[model samples]
Target chain A: MQGSQFRLEHGKKVRLANMDPNETGSLHDREEAEPNIERLKERLEALQNMLYAEKKQSVLFVIQGMDCSGKDGVVKRALGGLHPQGFQVHSFRTPTEEEEAHDFLWRAHRIVPAKGMIGAFIRSYYEDVLITRTHKWISEAEVKKRLKHINRFEKLLESSGVKIVKIFLHISKDFQLAKLRNRLTDETKRWKFDKNDLVERESWSAYEEAYEDVFKQCSTESAPWYVVPANHRWYRDLAVLQIAVDALESMRLAYPASDPELDQLLEQLQE
Target chain B: MQGSQFRLEHGKKVRLANMDPNETGSLHDREEAEPNIERLKERLEALQNMLYAEKKQSVLFVIQGMDCSGKDGVVKRALGGLHPQGFQVHSFRTPTEEEEAHDFLWRAHRIVPAKGMIGAFIRSYYEDVLITRTHKWISEAEVKKRLKHINRFEKLLESSGVKIVKIFLHISKDFQLAKLRNRLTDETKRWKFDKNDLVERESWSAYEEAYEDVFKQCSTESAPWYVVPANHRWYRDLAVLQIAVDALESMRLAYPASDPELDQLLEQLQE
Candidate 1:
């Protein structure tokens, strides 16, 4: 998923969520939910230390997907091992009157991670393209301008030493329908099912087209996007974890040495 | 800290991090820094399921303290368990021109957790009282207004079913000086020591007085402050853990029932 000019086979499915070409297993197949928890813990812990040690580079994860495509669940599981202090998650909403006065990226620009931190945007600046293009919330010309602005914004972040990882959780509309039904049937969950989600689902095709364009235009070499098949929750979690671990491992960070070395300090502290 | 009159004593050094005050032994008395990982895992797992099941009443842990007082460490330790998906941590900065244009609470209001999630505000609305008051960033009259606003804000959150747990990590200025000195001396840690921290340290007394006044006024029957003595990291972590567990234990939340009524439906799915 990393690097430039990687060829992903284009599928006929208009819906981005349903475009996964993999067809070997059912949702409940053994490989679908398999996780090596012990290995993951070691990898996550080591990388977290490296991040703390390097203390100069940052990682930003951007999550975008259809409702119930498992964006929330993926975020929860993938970064669950990291220290909360080292990470922050920001979810964007409709711009307020004040936010309207500035460029769309202003709010997000300020929230970008500082050196050595990890920041995640649940639904981010990409909304300017997805929501705007689908709803005609802004001008078509403005949308094009935003696509350019996003590429530049991400490049700027990379230049400033922030590693950007973007994930688009892809799930079938049938899965979404099931989740929506579950939300409606489960009294405890009914509050989470916003009426707008239903309204948005009706415009699924429009959103799919918007998102497809968004990926093509905004997936820069500095910050690439991974389209993860998310009809199965476990698979979605595993894919996100793999991406995070991969990025951190590539950095090869290690715990900082103590003055006179950690051996001496550990002995002293122990005494 | 519970009940009508708010009768937790005014002095004699209290640590909110101590989950059970009557359980003896100061945190510094411990010989090792090892967490009771087994107990933590169990409790965390249970808390996770509770959060997943209730999925309505969100939790907000708000941290306020002097620089080097261990707010970040406390936050890290308390939330060590639990999946990060259901959780979020937001660290506030100086408001942008856009944010400054609105009422003080506008940015914060938008970020409050939806039902069934957890959020931590590292430096929250309380800054309007602590930092702004000491720095004279806002006028004295404005500080007074903010104190009232904070009380109302917290009360509103409580009424709206957001659990607000406020922790004021209390460490003596001398302890902070030692920590700051260590940071300055260590090459790896030198970057952690900001010049502004030193500037803020100089106004320690003024900040303390401002905090004292804010605590007295805004520490209500609903969202009381927990002043944890944090000179010892082990004790600080334990104290915060206890407070978090206490907050959850008191909430009267239970796992969603897979009721007998739904049993037949669930059994059919299993078959």
Candidate 2:
């Protein structure tokens, strides 16, 4: 229930300066949170099974964060327990020419989860507003127009029974520098280091401002955005798991109504 | 080591009558196999990380079997340990209208894993030979022609740094019957029982004959088909996990060569 505190209020003027990326409410360390994390993971897996059986609704976790914010880690640790057959993860990176030729949402719209499945999008369509705005790729008027279109597109998906949970894995500037340093020094992790990440790190403040603007404009009641403190890896995974279980539980998922015909089929199968 | 026994020799005539679905090598029970399965899973994870780091080669596992042969279950239990970001599973069901218009390999070619990723096709192009031949959907000559094309297509993938490990989950007819009965009788599992599966059960022998023909024709040295005994779920998972780990290990996965520049970047960050 404490995960609800991170939900940015709809239409509120949001600011990243107010959040503590190291905040792990009431939990001291990974040891304390391990049991609860396991419990919530089981709950999530069970709820996902019911959702798959019902075939009525789907859940999408929209994960957005800077390079070291652990967007990929959260998905692997939290949502990975769902039956892989019914779970999918799509990471949105630099768009291709074909994707750019279409509208901004074209690439994302193509990969939306069907009913009875859970999907996690890493670095999702929000990058259009966050990265594009920070880089000044589109005009201010166009950015505002695109944000409006995004709100409407999400609303359309909500109407069609897609429950969206948007999360921003908030990590501090100091933490990112440490991560980059660690990546460079660790022989095994050196492969993950991209020099472009250093280039983007220069626009840190601008990216924050851009993301704050997005939070204010598009965080709706149906699909609210949660800014999670992600510096503490264990707490971040636990919080995301809680948030996922809460979202699926709220859907009131149930198996489809039992059919008497199945009983007849069972009798025949026995024979 | 025992998993190799299941590998049907390339171009050799394969017959279901010569094998037992309940074979578990020397292991007697699930408890005995659990530790080996766990070890293979960890080996698979480590090898996968190396493969992702190398980013030079990809591995594809082509899974095929009868309807109740546990194709979906094998994917979840055996290969699900993989990092979700680098692992993709695409189940090939009935093709779309456009897919039917194109060559049989088109739908499959599009989804093959790029460098440093692993892909599993639950039912693959071999279905063109097996099901199409069994149902008389294609002429006998056409089936043979398609099998030849499949051989060439797989060879092309192999030559281009793709390691293919094809698996057949060989469950017995009585085993499938028990599974069907369980699906109908179990309230929670009733959703999985399709009426058409029972309809297809009538052509069980035809499907077996078709699969044997495919094994004899398309199972080549570079991508030999493994006819795994899948009656015992525990043994099935263990065998598949061993096959996957062995395939990845055989690739000689290694991290990319270290760059001299990253250490310089690390010092600059320290400043």
Candidate 3:
């Protein structure tokens, strides 16, 4: 029941090899968690409605994972039942020509959800650290510099009433290989399979080590990264939904107080 | 019933003096227009829901007007009924130090409504053409240069699946003076009064001329400017609501087609 146990503590060294991606705390089977997930979805929708009415703060869910780690699936299944008007999903891909002209954070900063809104970033600014470091595109010194910039950016956003929830979908290498095979064999999902994924798979341990560094460096008290056990899709969805609902509930959101003058104005309009 | 007359044709010369701010076109009384406004609001909400579900084109309402010409009121009364989750209001005041460092359109470009969202800018980038030119802050050549930039910026947004609706809330000089007087006398509204408003009042004719040039130079077939008569608040709201509903309806938005595998997935979840 304590979701915070999954949060990577700030300043602590992370060993991804030691963490179990298949662990489902306190749940023996998917059947036991199914009804609870349904209940959490309803709670999320209600909380999202109040957040929109309150119009004071926003929540940002940053979902990052390797290929076939179910980042997109989690968003579609765990969060899809909420009102589309309040919830927006932004998938960050290769930077465009115009986007490259600015600093790395510029594009991400511009689209952070405004007050009374919920936004999810499927593979977010973290890519600059993960892919670039994994490919040796940036020096270790440069990676360190970018990590500081990211921390500062998150602090800036938090100061402006945005609650940042960083979730890393943790999947075993075998799970990813299986998912990739399914994508290749399934007609409906073949479009999702990319040959480049194989190239990245060769550096799986490097990516995991890089993510461990991200956990150790970027996790903060205000915006901590949660490592969700994502080998099981049902457990992944349920755990992520629970974490999201808990984050918003911690904000203590409520509708703005009604003005007495508006009541008088309503009477005039009716008359 | 015809709203097309309010749309300024691209490349046409606009004379603000010739356009009547008091005209309600074919409607003689507020009672006659009240029902139509209600109907349009309902239509707008329905269309907006589908637009959000479709997640394709975005809408930007650029509202510009003289002081006390009901820009804020129009957004509240005309658009207030729409879901706050999908509707966002951004009031552009003086540029910040960081904003001033970039091109004039940089801040605005960063915040244009994303797909399936509606964004309203109370005073938009057009302020560069209107206020700066009226006060002689920039040279005539510079004004011409910025106008060209504004047009290109808007064209960029339009090409990216954004439907831009430029509205000028047209109010007469006498109406403005009366509103200023009321702001001074009304205790609840006194906070809204600015001494600079009176100083800007001296340049009313200059602002009109500047806005006329903006209409002539920046208006395009894709995103035309509409001058809404604003002496009558009810009529102004009705006209704006009608124009917005028509603009969205023209987009012909629909929910994204359901996936064929969704039914099977739903059954799996239920089991």
Candidate 3 lDDT, tens digit per residue, A144-205? 99999999999999998999999999999988877876765554455455668878999999
Predicted structure 1: lDDT: 0.71
Model 3 in CAPRI terms: which quality? Answer: incorrect
Question: What DockQ do the predictions score, one after another?
Answer: 0.20, 0.63, 0.04
By lDDT rank, best first, the candidates go 2, 3, 1
For B1-271, candidate 1 gives per-residue lDDT tens digits of 2222112333233333333322324333534434553355457556755775677688888888888887767666657666665677777888889999999899999999877788889898888778888988889998888888887888888888888877877777777877877775666465455657867888977887887787678666566677765677766666666677677777877766544544454344344
TM-score of 3: 0.55
Best by lDDT: 2
Task: Tell the DockQ for candidate 2.
Answer: 0.63
**For model 2, how does the per-residue alpha-carbon lDDT over B1-271 read when each residue is reduced to its tens digit?**
5557778886788789678999988899999999999999888988988998998999999999888899988988888788888888888999999999999999999999988889999999888888788889999989879988998998889888999999999998899999998888776777888888887889988998898888888777778889999999999999999888878878888889988888888888999
**What is the RMSD, in Å, between candidate 3 and the native fold over all Cα?**
9.9
The local distance difference test score of each candidate is 0.71, 0.89, 0.85
TM-score of each: 0.65, 0.97, 0.55
Interface RMSD to the true structure, each candidate: 7.3, 1.5, 11.4
**Which model, 1 or 3, shows the larger DockQ?**
1
Q: Candidate 2: lDDT of A132? A: 85
Fnat value of model 3: 0.00
How would the candidate models be sorted by DockQ, starting from the highest? 2, 1, 3
